[model samples]
Target: MPRWRSRTRAERRLAAEQQGHRGEALAGLLLQMKFYRLRARRFKTPVGEIDLIAEKRGAIIFVEVKSRGHQGSEAEALGAVNSARIVRAAQYWLARHPAESGKDMRFDVIFLAPGRWPRHLINAFSAS
Candidate 1:
């Protein structure tokens, strides 16, 4: 392949990997929703996007999906998930929904990694 083509493919692969990780996280969340008898959907927002939104017995859930296959600690990456991004995304989410505006809500992060157990960290952070 030409150098340009190879570089394009690499970029596409990275995008695909990121998207795949999100899909895996959503799938895991679906399993959790099922286990808890909740209803869920993938969400898209203007400010910040959420991978999944689940509502169980009472509360609303907003989920962020992160890839967790780093060889070393992910202190840097986790830190990079700053409050501003969360706020932006959350604003996008909240602005789009009228009915859910008044409901109780929470944020969760589901980690996606190969050969590693799935980790669902509930209430990962309060809304910014």
Candidate 2:
């Protein structure tokens, strides 16, 4: 169960919004690893949010996917992968999964563009 805050109708609405966010995160992550199988999602942490966590080639990858409503500039979509955010998310992900601390970890990003194929950036950036 993901960290969802919902107790009343209004809370339910917020939960819905959070759930939607989680879904988008999952979608972006899946788009990246669609060739592989889904392992898990909504990886938690005190630093930031990790949209999706999947394993491929025996490597545990932490993916931070950002999808924006199409913008005029192509760079706008790619800009979503900020270094600070990626580091925070990766920190959170690694902190939660100690077993994966020693495994090959990668930070990736997937940009969902309008009327265009999703752009997958593999090992696009590193926390170091």
Candidate 3:
């Protein structure tokens, strides 16, 4: 078993939070390299929150960042529940930014694991 498997709930929470931060950082850097303009980070709405929002070439991307010490859980982290939340949050975001409402939107997921490069999945899910 992994060391985290033995950790308490609170410990695991803290570790997860730290991992999320690191993952977001890496994702942001990757987006920057791709020349995407970051519009938001940790965007919050009444329904849910989006980890990152970036725009490039008239398209806006809503990104979900997930980090785990084990790569196996990456798929689990990007499950339906998470995608639904991101869609809801993105809706809220678009409502608040009416000027950008006409732009094309895409949902993306960035998975991070220890000692591995961050993997960005574009158009990973959809609101529909």
lDDT of 2 by residue, 1-128 (tens): 79876499988778766754864665655655666445556666666666677777777766656655553454665565666876777776677778878888787776654566666677867778
TM per candidate comes to 0.67, 0.67, 0.87
Best by TM-score: 3
Model 3 regions more than 4 Å off: 1-8
Q: Encode model 1's per-residue lDDT on 11-118: one tens digit a residue.
A: 978987777667655555555756643343445555555666677656777666666555334455456456566656666666677777787888776665566655
Deviation (Å) of 32 in candidate 1 = 3.8
Show pairs that collide, candidate 1.
48-89
lDDT of 3 by residue, 69-123 (tens): 7866666777733777788889999999999999999999888877788888899
Candidate 1's TM-score: 0.67
Ranking by lDDT: 3, 2, 1
- Where does the lowest 10-residue lDDT sum fall in candidate 1? 36-45
- On lDDT, the candidate that comes out on top is 3
Q: List residue ranges in candidate 1 displaced over 4 A.
A: 1-42, 72-74
Q: Which consecutive 10 residues in model 3 have the weakest lDDT in total?
A: 72-81
At residue 44, give the lDDT of candidate 1: 53
